[model samples]
Target: MSAVLISVAELQELLDTAGSRVRLLDVRWLLGDPDGPQHYLDGHIPGAVFVDLETELADPPSAAKGRHPLPDLAHLQKCARSWGVSDGDTVVAYDANGGMAAARAWWLLRWGGVADVRILDGGLPAWEKAGGKIVSGEEPDPEPGTVVLTPGHMPTVDADGAGGWQGLLLDARAGERYRGEVEPIDPRAGHIPGAVSAPTAENLTDTGHFKPIEELRARFAGLGSGPVAVYCGSGVTAAHQIAALATVGIDATLYPGSWSQWSNDPKRPAATGTEPA
Candidate 1:
């Protein structure tokens, strides 16, 4: 089993084990859904606490800093403790959209130096399919935790570094977006120069769970000889890319600012029509 992922079956077993200390976080969010709380309130994995993607998982949006800048470490620690996370506790985060949004929590927690964070593969629907019962309404506030935090557990790239990145710079958006065919959000269309199109969607199967480890490894094999970094619309799906890569024993950096930050700057060059310009 990959350290970065847990199957629905595994999660159910963990929850079933008496006296097991597992923290489940229901991170049910989408790009444009501001009503994540409402959806979570309707029903969620029993004992799962809701985490707001826009507020808790990211700092405020800014023209210079991008839509979802990394939250302050102290603030993040406060949020984690609010979720009842303590040191050495195994945390599982999941969402309705495959593991796309949930990967943010997994990445952020790992970046904050939590050792045992994992994404519940296939997410909420998978849990329900596995006959896992759900509970509605707000969960009780947990006792404050004493988990300390430190950053830099994972690597990252800035706009300047991404422009001149020595290793492979992967654009994790859809292929059409990479080709500048369409862009639903952000300042401009297209992607950074010299970036290869490695859509994060390909990392998953039709069932929404991640592809097998061998398949993932083959999909990414020979893309880079040195370090690799990934970015997407606002750096959300890029974390999904990073999580997929981690399953295959490949460490990758994230351009947290992503295209949202890069396209805002007039001087930063944007390329269209793909071909890894």
Candidate 2:
């Protein structure tokens, strides 16, 4: 619903200028990592607030709703407020693992009706490479935000919608997972029927920055002609897939329940191997 990414230099400029009112969020998370907050405390962009993706950004894990189900709207609003986000604030989110985890914050803010939010392109390493400063310990409590939030600013597809999707339904997990060769967390192996493997890792370059816009366009070209939707193991990296698509001016719907929820169901048939079922 908003611009997908911001350069480290651009973000620095904003932070340097007086009254930029930039609300920086460090969404430090990895699939199996429980040390996100510890990582943030060890070193982070000065004044950047830490947001726990597993708690603040998502509802409790459930077999029916998925591991990282979208949090309740009111709770999300409270979380954003605690992050010191005021109305009209420019929010920048980042993480060490590319923008893989950071994109979750980027997507949630945009979906929460905040118009000016973006992922820090290339994430933490990008800023460090540019000689950006880092600080240890928690930041001072910012003035609590007065921002209000509404939902549905972004498009989504539920399990039924994903199954009946008319256009591309991309499985954004690793190719091996998509092929049913390996599923690390979910209950099942393989992808939803009619889904295509489009691993989120390919969306980035070796340095973890998003690939060039034209490259992204070429990567997704000819996959489908109608609307587009994406889902990952849970729903976390799916937002990264959407962010990559946004760079190429493509809008994508998210299946928040994603494979985690889909696989939990006994009735939803799954497809395996290299081809769409």
Candidate 3:
């Protein structure tokens, strides 16, 4: 079976036979929030290892880049080796925030040419709600598989590239952020020129669970795209948009640096007080 997505029940059934080959990752982190690892240390799914989003998944912040830049491929390969993730292993990842962080792992794994990856549906909360097993302790070790890194999967475009590309650039921030009306995280208020606003929050209901697949299809269909490229302040929330699009068979790519990096360079054009062009 293709490594798409698996529910708690489906994972439970698979755990009996493929437990050793299945590498479970708990990717939980929050922007400007320091309590993520502490929460993970308190409790997590049994046999799951914690993957820090900022340190493990992304490169350090730079002057001309976003807060959560994409990590170096060589560094990530080492991390995969440490986690016992060989090229042949089936990796599963989950996060507390409805696959936001987990999607990062999924994207990174795919970018590294590891196709046998799946995100746990509904994340940790759903796992706990389903009465799945939990354990608190140091992460266990697995036999490392061959680590193979690939390129060209990281689909990113600069301001000029975005303007010239045929794909629709979907901004996944709140309307206020996208409009450059409010400045909460980044110093700049505007977004990239010609980018459409498609907030990730719209993908979820009031309860924070993902909306139905049909609803997601309707939402993405409204974008009218040749190809879809999703972005956010620092590429985190944008993953939510990608996940939503994937549910609807949209298969959108992510602009990893996103608005944070775009706004850093004064030369790049930024649009304020305007809708997408």
Instruction: Put down candidate 3 lDDT per residue, 1-277, tens digits, no spaces.
Output: 1245677888888788888888888898777777878878889998888888888889999757688888998989888877778777788988888787788888888778886888887788889998998878676566665778776564666656655558688889888988889978776888887788888878876645678878888878887778888889888888778867876777777887887888777777778765785
Question: How does residue 122 of candidate 1 score in lDDT?
Answer: 90
Best prediction by lDDT:
2
Best by TM-score: 2
TM-score of 1: 0.97
Q: List TM-score per model, in order.
A: 0.97, 0.98, 0.93
In order, candidate lDDTs are 0.90, 0.92, 0.80
How are the candidates ranked when ordered by TM-score, highest leading? 2, 1, 3
lDDT of candidate 1 over 97-192, digit per residue (tens)? 879999999999999999999999999888888888988998888777779999999888788989999988899999999999998898788889
Model 3 clash pairs are 86-145
Residue-pair clash count for candidate 3? 1
lDDT of 2 by residue, 1-277 (tens): 2267889888888888934589999998997789999999999999899999999999999998999999999999999999999898999999999899999988998999999889998899999999999999989988899899999999999999999999999999999999999888999999999998999999999999999888889999957667899999988999999999998889999999999999999999999999989
Ranking by lDDT: 2, 1, 3
Against the hidden true structure, what lDDT does model 1 obtain?
0.90
**Where does the lowest 10-residue lDDT sum fall in candidate 1?**
12-21
lDDT of model number 2? 0.92
